[model samples]
Target: MGHWWDRNIIEPGKLPLLLALAAFVLTFLITRVVTRLIRAGKGPFGNVTAGSVHIHHVVPGVVLTVIGGFGAVASGRHGFGPALSAVIFGIGTGLVLDEFALILHLDDVYWSEAGRKSVEMVVLTAALVGLLLAGFVPFGVNDLSEDELQNRAGAVVSIGVNFLFALIALSKGKARTAVFGVIIPVVALIGSLRLARPGSLWARRFYRRRPRARARAVLRAYHHDRRWAGPRRAFGDWLGGKPDPPHPLERD
Candidate 1:
């Protein structure tokens, strides 16, 4: 285990990245716990307010992100300075992404259904970073043989094909698949072969003339959402607290 860590992480100068990932996940978890406590009114933690306005954590997050980003760039990849800067950047990222929904809608909706997007984004970011730390290279270039890498044409062709698959998956509204596909070409290939989502650009452009294909796509979407939505929501709620009850007008 120690040898693997040294070879895969230390030798590759990935310690800062690992530190950043750890810090990001830890900061998010801590922020969630504090916010949940405030929501329940069970702790001394309270919202930061100034006069008539409430100060969101994203403010400080932006500040830290700027500082850490520049600091990391200046510190270089080796030594403790880079690692510390990485941690700071990670913390800033956590705070910023926690309020992502609020930024998107320009309103306070922390406990509303819209706020769930923040949790989803956080999870996605963490997953991608984790994959990177686990040695998955973006654009599927890591799978190339040494000889193929030396052949510039072969490398370019491989990358181009993989990128096409990712693009197709994105057009089909398979965002997660597209994202992971950048690191693993097979994932993108699978996504490209799947039916497009009903509301996606691919469906509108390609499935428009094919009524049967459209119907099948819609049906697949419905069943897929029905099967996974509940578990996905449950996991989100477990991590970020359940959303507030809907308003009466919304229910109506």
Candidate 2:
């Protein structure tokens, strides 16, 4: 009873969950505000990205990371003991989400150079590995208890979900976006499948969206490719072998 009270008093897990949800909502609100602010401040034609890095990427990411990290700590420490392990693991998970957001924002603003993209892949892979190893470290500080382990696993799952969301958002256009977009979601789907173990709540939720997401992907592909109405036309005859369709939905 005392332990329960202590856990509730010191760091209630529900608080973290509520905080995480609030952060998500706030981020969305901020996005809308920033969009309007940009339109008003930059003028209709002013470059939103011209010569300056916007806080949109950094601010929301920082807020989200904090929310996620706190939630992880709260959940893991529910029973008792220090939640440091949960916090550490949670932070790693938060980092992954932030990284995903950063990538999405970066892609939206500027195409990554091949070399830079490669470096990104390497760095992320390293970070994940390091985080996993940290969980297993046997420092004098409390080794991760069972709840902490579960929280760490949950954090990993959370990151995967965030990655999927990023993929869906980024792959939301025709042709050029389609080319890269198709590959990413498929990979994400595979990851989601692997994460979806029996009785895992996160896995269940992730799987639920798979079909709709796939449908969206198909529509995006068709929308982008439909612009190339005809086949094998000479290059100079029209842009990219065909004129842009009046609209992607207009069928022959």
CA-lDDT, candidates in order: 0.94, 0.39
Please provide the root mean square deviation of candidate 1 (C-alpha atoms, Å). Answer: 1.1
lDDT of 2 at 24: 38
**Candidate 2 local lDDT, residue 49:** 50
Stretches of model 2 off by over 4 angstroms after superposition: 1-13, 42-56, 63-102, 108-252
Best candidate (score: TM-score): 1
TM-score of each: 0.97, 0.27
Model 1 stretches with alpha carbons more than 4 Å out: none
For residues 30-142, write the lDDT of model 1, one tens digit per residue: 99999999999998999999998999999998898898899999998667899899999999999999999999999999899999999999999999999898888988888
